[model samples]
Target chain A: MLVDRLNSTARRVPTWIVYAGLSLPAPWLFWQGLTGGLGVEPIKALEHEYGLLALQLLIAGLCVTPLRRFAGVNLLRFRRGLGLMAFFYLCCHLLVWLVLDVQILAQVWADILKRPYITVGMAGFLLLVPLALTSTDRAIRRMGMRWRQLHWLVYPAVLLGGLHFVMLRKGWQLEPLVYLGLVAILLLLRLAPRRKRVAAHA
Target chain B: GTALVGLAGAGEAQEALEPNGWDEITSYCNYYEFGTNKDDPSRYAGQLTTDPWSVTIDGLVERPGEYSFADIIAKMTIEERIYRFRCVEAWSMVVPWNGFELADLLDLAGVTSDARYVAFETAYRPEEMPGLRFPVIDWPYVEGLRLDEALHPLTIMATGIHGRPIPNQNGAPLRLVVPWKYGFKSIKSVVRITLTDKEPPTAWNKANPREYGFYSNVNPTVDHPRWSQASERRIGAGLFARREPTLMFNGYEAEVASLYEGMDLRANF
Candidate 1:
């Protein structure tokens, strides 16, 4: 019954409202960074917050298919918005690290090349660029089956994002490991056998 | 060298020092005994019991016994030394510490001729330290220094900061402050000091040997595996403040460079 109620509510809520709601934290976090609300090292805190938000959005986007199949709560319309927002947050995360944290242009390249975690994070960001570019309804209709195939890149991109977080920490910390575990479970849910639809003619 | 003399004199010169704010120094800490978060120490360190503290002095020393904090303080002359505090994570602060030189304490203990190293250990009360429950590091947090380094004039055992008694989060009763080395080398809330012949295990080195080395001197040229050591962010330096270029031996090269003479710093680091 709760699932039914959630489905009904989801239908009435415009997808644009979801975009508007999720985007509110972006400006708020920027304000926090400027006003010392993020403590003494606001740049580092802001970078972490943005990266974490991107990962969370990616995980939420992953859940759409599973929720629809298992609980019949269709959120197909919101999937593109969720994905695009995740990419937007990911760009914010990268920009913070580039422009604010590591200001030196040469050092940034050095980190991307030498640091394994940075390399993995950069790869994930690169993977999402094409997805973000092809997210429009017109582009989806133009490509059709190819667009579906292209969007599957999100699975590996999100996996790398989780791994990047796990490696970023000093040691085997529980928080990053928990994020990686959640991503793995969501990806696994896709492997379950699909229910066969009954044919009326047959 | 003349530069060495000038720098040594500068330590005692009555120059107006710009130390970080008390709140910044007290709140932003890396005392992992409380928790991993920067504010964790400020939040949870209140539970630590610091009064009536005693330090166990043992190993190749003439005076090897449990010395009360009050007795140690009474025997030593306290002074203020403003020094640059640099963390291995590429952040730094200027701290005005109140304490006597560690060399004076070593002199009181009378280190034996064969003693080559000095080892220190932090208080390990599991009931008081919640962070100890997780094996973030090998517990009882240990650190060590060469006998010469331990006796360096710049190395001090700090009891207070900014003319007041240190907060529980900032190693209340006693802590080591080796200005030239990384901040982790300055073990906090020390309870044991041992004079030994061999190099003792340090917490960060044991946690990840590749990243942390025994010497851990603040060298700009040598980079940590994950990050650069060339520049450091100054805490409380505002959101848009540019990072300052880190100095070799944290600008104490005049006094400390001789300690590592004829040795390769990059290899040692």
Candidate 2:
């Protein structure tokens, strides 16, 4: 079948390539930031870009199941890499906000408590931690079925990430709303009857 | 030190000790009509037509008429005024604006005695400003000032910046510059001015009243619903620079504080 052939082909492609490809934007952004290419408040520009990129990668990781089921294209081999990269970018985003934007460690806690967007974003990051740590093949072998259950946390994490973006914007914005809708639709796709067909195949 | 000395020589003290570079000022702008991103305005605002502009002066004014931009400039005595421009978003810049006081324009229009407020409106061209297509702000952005505030010597109707005609991204033809209030209060690319007895509706206030108050004075004490207003990052400061403590009325309190005397700033803010 085409699905078997595609899965074999996707597996041959080294997953490290995904990491190398996704990592390109960081150096470019750093260069732009250092050279005054980022217009007023470079740190803010950098932080925003990192956060948005993380959200995009998380969405891409979520697309793997829907794509395999609906289109018979298997990118499951690269899914773990995509998820880890997303977590990496999210860490960069959080660190930038903490070290550069806020600076004061004491105020960071105050901000997390006071600001709804920060609270939501921090919650999202915390939820993603277990998924990222358990992304290894060894963890999958050890945890077995329990591993999949824990990794399901990606749904709430991605949703909270989208909600964090929406809450941070100044007013009613179209882009953030669209992102939230996309995340909702991706999550809804997983709850469909096709899940039973996939489980039976497994 | 050199930059301050040059400004001091020009008799423009009380300017930011380190004024923003001309490139920084021009490149970074928050003209929401063009877009929300700071870079969006500089990229798109060039398409905006500023020539052959006319401002409709109406309401409680005796000499109500559409005054051409050329005629207005010809009639007014223009001079350079260095002022601190503070955004409600807790960022600021010291800009050298060239224009006449808003009081001069009010005088020319012959504001009626009953008029208590001066309302201003920005040009709303959907074709030029793609942001207008979205409901980011009410089209034809409206802002207002109290009559006394309008008449304040520091309140200017700016036409130019950095010793040249104001760039399109920075409100090309004519823009109000209420130095003591948050930047949004200084409505840009003005097309209409109305003197009224009642307080005029402002764009930000109409959008989110809970967050953006009608009287968006630069008070460090009163915070925005989501963010602290106690400190602001100076625009030209490099990436590693720290935020400086924001001052009351953005450091113009000595000049404009009495205008709000006996009023509750917390409530108004």
Q: Give stretches of model 2 more than 4 Å off.
A: A1-8, A195-202, B1-16
Candidate 1 docking quality: incorrect, acceptable, medium or high: medium
DockQ, all candidates in order: 0.60, 0.58
Interface RMSD of each: 1.2, 1.4
Which 10-residue span in candidate 2 chain B carries the lowest summed lDDT? B1-10
Score chain B of each candidate by TM-score.
0.96, 0.94
Q: Give the range of the ten consecutive residues with the poorest summed lDDT in model 1 chain B.
A: B8-17
lDDT of 1 by residue, B130-227 (tens): 88887777888999999999988888999999999989999979999999899999999999999999999988899999999999999999999888
lDDT of 2 by residue, B42-138 (tens): 9999999998899999999999999999999999999988888888877788888899989888887999999999899999898889888788666
Give the winner by TM-score: 1
Give me the displacement of residue A88 in model 1, in angstroms. Answer: 1.3
Global lDDT of each candidate: 0.90, 0.87
Which CAPRI quality tier does the interface of model 2 achieve? medium
Chain A: TM-score in each model? 0.95, 0.92
